[model samples]
Target chain A: MEFSSKLLENAVNEISQLPGIGKRTALRLALHLLRQPKENTHGLSKALNQMVDDLKLCKSCHNISDTELCDICANPMRKTDVICVVEDIRDVMAIENTASHKGLYHVLGGKISPMDGVGPHDLNISSLVEKVKSGSVKELIFALSPTMEGDTTNFYIYKQIKEFEVETSTIARGISVGDELEYADEITLGRSILNRIPFENSLKL
Target chain B: MEFSSKLLENAVNEISQLPGIGKRTALRLALHLLRQPKENTHGLSKALNQMVDDLKLCKSCHNISDTELCDICANPMRKTDVICVVEDIRDVMAIENTASHKGLYHVLGGKISPMDGVGPHDLNISSLVEKVKSGSVKELIFALSPTMEGDTTNFYIYKQIKEFEVETSTIARGISVGDELEYADEITLGRSILNRIPFENSLKL
Candidate 1:
């Protein structure tokens, strides 16, 4: 799109650099910004710059945070002994939102996908190993997705810290509460059947 | 969605303020920005702030520009006597991209929408009237959209400039090229039929 203003064109170009936003969408966003009060642009740019500059990674779990230690790891009420290992900060947010877990998290940053050039060393496996080696963590729950990459990362982390004598378990794979068992994939349905828990355990939720 | 960082939360809130972006998408975009190099965030923020701060409205056409007069209005090759009226800068950009018209533009800023509390006084119509009153402009083309508000704007402007003795015309309304007649909307098809041009005129392009 030809822009009469160079500033408009530059803003649109920078905005379209974001994931999933095309030139048309960037133009729409830019025009929307133009129509709003001047303070709106200042607010947006300030927020973005602050987010970038003030952003920090939790030293313990490698999760994105504003401080050295994330809220989950810093909370004494939450059990640091039980570390829920996951792929990224989004997973941390998702699990925290559910309130299903009362433990700290170990964000691996990404899965160990050889196809994507992400190896075990590329993740936070070494620090997680160090945490387990400190003899404080008693359990490491694998909450990564059930994909091959997720399983591989889980196994790799487990192997790295198995000698520390920590209890390790994967999150349950089963037919969701509202899902039909028949519609579930063969492996998931089969696993659900094999790993069936007591009726009272399913009643917790 | 709960965020671990206040900066992240603020950024997400500001980003989702944009049209069509939701909370989840905002978080995704914010996280994506965080994952990139620091320079990327700086570049984006700088571009947005600079765009807002350095922006200017062309004195002649009221289009967004870097100077008093927009490039098209300032161009000596373009016909100064002919003015294509449009609702906003985007419409000007769309027409300019087509390269079909070589006339100067008079951006009205917006249409007359009483329901939305927008009236002729809210737009840049007075400046346009002054341009027509100058008597240097001979042809005032109504290139505004076909919507009710656009037509109202066109009619309002025509009335304002009619005493100036300038010729007025609207952009053609017809079935789009490569569109099926059966699938075309009723009003557009009817107008296309009613305003049928000579066979030789149709063969010009």
Candidate 2:
């Protein structure tokens, strides 16, 4: 349907491109934005522009950052020897919220989803293997999702690091399935982290 | 939860302020924006900034426009003599989508809702009465919702214009009830407009 203006229609189209937002919801969002004060709109626009201009993927961890290395990767206080591997930056946030995992993180960007054309090459799996090869890390924790793609990625990473003396483990997955690690409640994810199992043990079971 | 970066969190917060968006939805939207090309983000940001910078309320009709008068009010093909009075610019768009109405529109901003502290003065009622008094307009069509506040506003405007030579009427209420006009499909709204009744005759009946 035609809207109040072309600009409004454009805004709605942009908003509807977001996951879970339909045309009617997009229109509602557009109208809400239109009713907001000028400063609110300006703040939103400025924030978006700043994200585009200033934000970058951290070279070390692949997490979003303002500088070359993300805060988690650059922090001297965090344990660099214990590396937690996740599918995305959101998982980093999820693990960080518990304040229990003091280890560093490696964001693989995504899992091995051949159906979606995402392969191991598309992820940061090589960097993760290189990190293990450095011999400094004592433990490699797999914090990937419990889904099939997550399992595939975890198995691939484990196989690459099997020769290393570093301990390789996957976070417990009984609590979450068929969902992103970001959506898992903090408590559940924290418990899962605490109850991790060795990759070989999981395969044996 | 601690996120990848402060800027990403800020963007998520701003997006969540839009109608019907929650934390998860906002995060999904933020992730989508992050994945978009630099040009797409720039275009979205520019559109938002331009919406705040360029749009203003039409002084005569109160419809949103980049200029003092909206396109409909400025168009020579539209019948200036028959003004379709609506609660807001959204209603004008709803009517415009029908492609049946050939008249100009007058937007009242909102209906009179005393419980919500919205009074007659809060609306553009005075400008509407003045337009009718100017004697240039031949008809004033009230395309308000079928709610208590809508009925109240319509009656108030009708009473103000009854003394003038202008023909006063209201769009049919067969398809809607109270604030539900925003949800009404286009065909229903169009049919309602076509079946409008004379204000004086409806009062007598």
Candidate 3:
């Protein structure tokens, strides 16, 4: 009774399995697709099929690519000495969009999570270590989210590569960003206090 | 800069062409498909292709079906004497879900709209006329929404079939339903008054 046709129901079920989508949204999407022309639907189907067949992880950076190396890894202008490490390919894309950093990237595929049965061996940590051990890389920036799992992954990787001569650092965390002191979270306030910068030229601290 | 990957961009563009889906939503859907297992994406693609290849319009009622005749048209229990004309198959399913109507259906494919270049000939109006001329049907119900185009289509069809010796009627339209009288629009209030039912249970009015 919920859906008009079995095909619609099946499509909705498949769409609902995606991240951030539910049954209602899936149903809406299905109805929308059904209203489109057959040529458009054919194009959508072909595109989906092609993505499944053509997409593969780069051997070097573990980022999604059609070839052995991702675009970032193949780019000559990118700084090879400073490699930014991220949990997923989407994160790599996010940083790439900023256009501020001109460094190369190494996608971790996933972070180490003991509860989820994912460990250091499961991720591309060994490859990262090997990349650092080659003596070409100098600094490794950890651009991970401020979450418990992210912290755990960061500490795990940090411990593994501490013996190496490469410098390790994480993205700065504190009062983000045009935030008033009254609305700032306790952890952010505390971190900002602990890592306060010296006020020299303008206002006296 | 438009899209990171050519394959992903193609997929997002194709999905965005579907009705009611924008570029951002299409990207979300494409990314969702990318994250799914290969077999799941294959199934979705197969389903979409199958729908395009296997689906056909029924010769009898013009509803979508896998066979020459739709399931509803072939059903013996459904009353052939009453035929409900609708804009699309979705409307048929909407009425069928109510479980009140026992009649057949005729999908017009779309309503008449000169602005969109959709005319009387563009829709399955000829097929509907032929079905009416068969003399098996006694009543034709216009179950279209209260849109200007729907009204125009209904009037056109009514003019075509008025000469035929059959009962012709339309689904009631007035103040809908659970609406407070004070908040009713002037047009709806006027229509409600014109079509108001008598309080007395008289055998004949």
Candidate 4:
């Protein structure tokens, strides 16, 4: 769209560069900012610049942090011996929200996707190996999504540290807790049956 | 959702304050920024802050501009005697895209909405009336949206300018150019029939 002001065009150009935002949406948002009090725009820009300039990545877990270590990795109460390996920090946040996993997280940053030109070296796998080789971690859980790339990454990491004395496992895969059996995909349904636990085990949760 | 970094949380909070953006979407956008190169985040923040800091409203039409008069108002090619009154600069852009009207514009900034505590004083209506009283304007087109507030605004301005010798008219209200008759709203279809021009006149376009 044609912008009367050069500054407006510049702002819209930058905003639309973001994922999922289009030129039309960027224009609407920029116009909305123009209509509001000056402080709102000032606050938005200041916060964004500050976050990018001062934000830190956890040295241990590879998760976002304000300090050298993320809160999860810094918390002594969490099970440091068990590290849940995942694709990105979003997964870390999702797992954290559930409060189900008390173990530490090792964000892989991204999975090994050859199609996307992302390989094992592109991930945080080496540091994970170092963490495992140090012998502090007793167990390493593969919490990556059940995709081809995820599975490949998991296998690659397992091969790297298989000689170590750490126990390795993947998160369980099956139908959702409240989903109908008929709606379950054939692969998932078959897996659920093959990996069936004792009837008593289902009642534990 | 819990954030590992206070800076991340602050950025999300500020970004979410924009119209239609929620907390989850805000976090997604902020994270997207973080994942990109540092230059991307710097560019976004710099553009946003610069636009808000240096932006100007045209003194004549109140369309956003960098100088005293907007490009259109300052242009000699456009007719200054005929003014198209609109609710905002977005309308100006819409009408400009049509390339149908070559006259200047008078932006009202916003409609008079009592439900939103917006009155005539909140708009640029007085300056518009003053423009008419100056006797330089030959005609004024009411190009506001076809809503209750739009109608109220048009009528209010009409009462203010009736004493002047300026010709006043509302933009045509009818079915859109490509709209099917069956799907056309009752009011629009009825108005299209009532305001039907002569067959030969329609051929002029």
List of clashing residue pairs for candidate 4: none
Candidate closest to the true structure, highest DockQ? 1
In model 4, which runs have C-alpha deviations exceeding 4 angstroms? Answer: none
Candidate 2 off by > 4 Å: A3-6, A175-205, B115-117, B175-205
lDDT of 1 by residue, A1-205 (tens): 7788889999999999999999999998998998898889999999999998989999998888899998888888997789999999999999998999999999988999999898888888888888899999988899999999988888888778878889999998888879976798999888888998999987995
DockQ of each: 0.83, 0.48, 0.35, 0.81
Clash pairs of candidate 2?
Answer: none
lDDT of model 1 at residue B11? Answer: 96
Cα deviation at A125, candidate 3, in Å, is 3.5
Give per-model TM-scores: 0.95, 0.80, 0.81, 0.96
Off by over 4 Å in 3: A2-39, A111-122, A133-136, A174-205, B2-4, B173-194, B198-205
In the range A1-205, model 3's lDDT, one tens digit per residue, is 4543466567668767766778776666665666666777778888988987897778888887777787888899999899999998678878888886798888887788889999888888988988888888899999988888899989988888888899988887888667788999899899979977767722761
What tens-digit string does per-residue lDDT give for candidate 1 at B1-205? 8899999999999999999999999999998998899889899988998888889999888899999888998899999999999988889989998999999998888899999999999999998899889898889889988999999999998888888878999999999999999999999999999999999998998
| Rank order (by lDDT, best first) | 4, 1, 2, 3
What tens digits encode model 4's per-residue C-alpha lDDT throughout A1-205?
A: 7789999999999999988999989999999998888888888888998998899999999999999988898999999899999999889999888999999999999999889999888888999999999999999999999989889999999999999999999999999999999999999999999989899998998
Give the better candidate number (1 or 4) by TM-score: 4
CA lDDT of B12 in candidate 4?
Answer: 97
**Docking outcome class, model 2:** acceptable
Local accuracy of candidate 2 as per-residue lDDT tens digits, A71-121: 888999999999999988778888898787898999898899999999889
Predicted candidate 4 versus true structure: per-residue lDDT over B1-205, tens digit per residue:
8889899999999999988899989999998998888899889988988888899999999999988888998899999899999999889999999998899999998999999999999999999999999999999999999999999999999999999999998999998888888999999989989999999998999
